[model samples]
Target: MLSLWDSWPLPLETAPPSSCSPPRSSCSARQRSCSCAHSVRPIVPPPATPRASPQYVHNSLGAHAVITNIDVTLRDGGYRNSFNFSPEYALAHARSSVASGFDWVEIGYRKGSSRPELTDGLTAHCDDEYIAAMAREVGPEHIGIMVHPGNLGEHDLDEAWSAGARLLRICFSPSDPRRSLECAQRAVEIGYVVCINVTRISTVAPKRLRRIINAVSGLGVTALYLADSNGSLLPDEVHALVESLISGHELAVGMHAHNHLGLALVNTIRAVDAGATWVDSAVLGMGKGAGNLVAEQWLAYLSQRRAGSDRFDLGSVLELSTRLGESVVEAAPRLDVTDMLLGYFDLSIEHSPRLAEIPDRHAQVRAAGLLAGADS
Candidate 1:
């Protein structure tokens, strides 16, 4: 009996363009045809009995390795002082992140030039020279960097790779699919493990998202990151999106969540359940507008659930979170039930700023406008 999984023909219409590349000219005609043509039916090999999914299937690399990498210094912590991370604090965070068994400790952005206001006393947001020094201090295996696609040029990318950045996150607005793919391909060419981040994904359509995933999958980048830029995604939505990306593409999937709706932790867990191998988190959830998934919360969940136990240190992570909160005066973003409800419905908060200010019928109208803007 042929099952759906057995000898299933590749869906040409949905296949990635890069996957359609012609076979090598050196191959024999028969071999080339067999390898390249989706229509070429091949003899079915004998089937083997199915095995149960591994216990660590939800974990990264199936090696009891947790994919919870801390990016506080770059994203969350940046908001604390406007990317004004002190060198001492940055060094301490790096050492702590690595010592706590974190797979990667993203230092900060490689923005083309430094804005003095944004970079005042900040070690993380410096040029490649500073990054190279930090990389030497933290070691290449633990250091990573984030870059906004619009801000970073090709030369900036080349310098980052030279500075020992093993991983590079390319952030893109979800509305622009072509730019996302182009950035991912360019990053790949420059020899970085590229992760394409679809920022503000709450505003995108499900069908359009599938197309973006397929397009970037064709680029053969390292990962695809679904960013809840508005901190607006619910747990079920996170699970559904992660599942769709994993099922449709060969690339690894990750999530960068914000806690504006207080769903960041659950959504991160849901992403893991839906086959996401990478989860971006911050210390005390200190990020833009709202904040991100808290590193300590994730560590505690893993410890209590007995998941990814070998890859995290709950005690150390808790201590680090405390220090980070104190270092930056971490404050949770002020979000109301209305904002939470609207966010769950894929609505933006720009609609009702006065809801918090005045809390009246007129505020409700403003919220409606925000939702309308998303649709428009």
Candidate 2:
């Protein structure tokens, strides 16, 4: 046989590109279809892969959605002082929220005829003029106002929008969601970014809560916020709830955690891990009963976890939080025995007035358990 080297059509050093190489588009159709090594293109190296931020995966529930932080200091903190937050304090809180990179600041509630005995404070009522001033002071884009489904009327959306309210949060009980849905529909029509808050989520049965969530998600609301009004939810529960709510819905899920068991931060963290995109916190944990998740602490945690990220200015938030302590003598968040009982029994803070009359702490807790059973 002839020498094996003599069988080659071209010398090894001058051989064409390998047959395994892909043909370039510039190659003629005949060349591309042929097995000839001359038709193959030279190999090109791929560009280097970018190094991803280590914290990016942990920042959310394995999703790329940006989480929105909401400051509810003026809105929820008012409960501690009987909704008596002064105009100056409210405006200052809104300013601080904006500076701290908060996405929204809920100034206060819009009063209705249903609860005439609540208080006469501007924050409680969130009168048109007060909202107008806050809108102007903080920029309407960052201003949010809450209203009970019962409190929201047909024309309330128009009034709120005209007064520069960009977001309207409707808080409603899961027992009856019709009114809340109606209000949300109206708000959508009026061009308000509406959030439907499911209050006392722990009290509702699982099936009922799922139905409520499904219904709200189908509506055109901007967000569906679950309110741990009793502060009875644990981290695991929050994770499951948030995960379930986010499974098939494109709607943004939010958490409004109460600090009854001192689990707000952990529960909120779990919610975020389960795809909740919005988080509510109050300065100094000032709110009703055991209070809400503390804003300063929450921001500090985020700042530490998301190192090198400048989304939130923890220093600015802390400064604003300290001012609350200075301005209000009774602004501290307290978790008394009564508050613990409220959380243990899954009783709402709204019933605290009734529980207070029991006189005995043991009896109070027992009464709460009974009340929760009855309410359920």
Candidate 3:
């Protein structure tokens, strides 16, 4: 069996693309047409029994396309506060979210032995105690925890499940894989909403993206999230990715956009318009670097898409972003030249681990950014 932790440069199709794989170039296309599954490889072959003609089922409740917003203020937003949020603040946000009709509230990261050594905040650690504490305040069903693929073990997941994390958002970087699908498989078995977050989607090539997607799409996870890690993707690219992902399955397609280019909202809307059903939003766009799509803004925009959108009360959303979470965004990041250059270069936010040892490293990066007119 091929291990998910195995080295990179996944196998690509030698033959031309056919009806089985519409996008002939994608690594998944070969899996679709199993006629030559093993003509070239020394590894396991594609699913012996075909995928029942690509039905594309889902958990949403509509024949018409709809948008479901997942609030990431606590998770991604944590990057701004070094993964520290007052338990009081987290519960208040959760309560506000329920009132505002948010589909899901991401509470924090679920770090394990694999996390980098740092002064991580309470939520970054997300001990059973923390998760349980958060669960006590908010309905466990309404909360989700974002975790990296390499960091967690079965025990970590078991503890999280016991602590009330019914939704698992596994963030995976194709550059350094950590058995993401295996994690999702575990999450699904535990009766959780499994969301596979393909982080840094723009940085990967189509073949690599397809390979990863193809590998995980069959896992029966609830959704596949494409994260614009560097906030570098344009609206068209967002649309393209959403379209391609939904083309092969009945599962929900989602988008998580960063605001490096000040296009988080635009890119998010484009993805939704292209059939993406799930979207992650931060109140006032309070997240890492330039932050993320504004929940209030995106929800308000989505509310106008159809009548009976009252299920999402913009007034409640407004109050939370302005009142309950206002201070949260008081520190919201601006779209600076450095952020723009990061997007332009399409760099992942993960700086070199070696830089962590250097003191005032953020200052150095900022200095470089300013020199590059990052402040302009």
Residues 1-376, model 2: lDDT tens digits:
1131133222112113223333323512111111111221222212322222223325345566666778887778877787787888888888887777787898888873136476557677877777777777767777788887676555666777777678988886433456667778778878889888877776555555555566666567878888998888777777876776786765888999999889999999888888887889998998879899998888888777754357777788888878889998668768877787677666777788788788887677667767755655
Give the per-residue lDDT of model 3 (tens digit) for 7-49.
6645532222223322422432112111111121122222232
TM-score of candidate 1 on Cα atoms, chains taken together: 0.73
Score every model by TM-score.
Answer: 0.73, 0.80, 0.76
Candidate 1 clashing pairs, residues 3+ apart or interchain: 76-286
**How well does candidate 3 match the true structure, expressed as C-alpha RMSD?**
12.3
Instruction: Give the per-residue lDDT of model 1 (tens digit) for 1-376.
Output: 1132133222322112122233323522111111111222222222321221222434322434335354554544575566777677777877677666666777887672123234434533556665665566667656678766666555676666666667877775443445556667777877777788766676555555665666666676877788886676667767766766676567777888877778889989888877787878887776655567877787677656744465666677767777776776644434555555445444444544544555665556455445444444
Report lDDT (Cα) of residue 271, candidate 3: 79
lDDT (0-100) at residue 203 of candidate 2? 55
lDDT of 3: 0.67
lDDT of the structure predicted as candidate 1: 0.61
Candidate 1 vs candidate 3, TM-score winner: 3
Name the regions of candidate 1 deviating beyond 4 angstroms. 1-68, 112-124, 174-179, 330-376
* Each model's total of backbone clashes: 1, 0, 5
Highest TM-score: give the candidate number: 2
The TM-score of candidate 2 is 0.80
The deviation in Å at residue 241 for candidate 1 is 2.1
Where model 2 places Cα greater than 4 Å from the true spot, the runs are 1-61, 112-116, 173-176, 357-361
Superposed by TM-score, candidate 2 places the C-alpha of residue 201 at a distance from the truth, in angstroms, of: 0.5
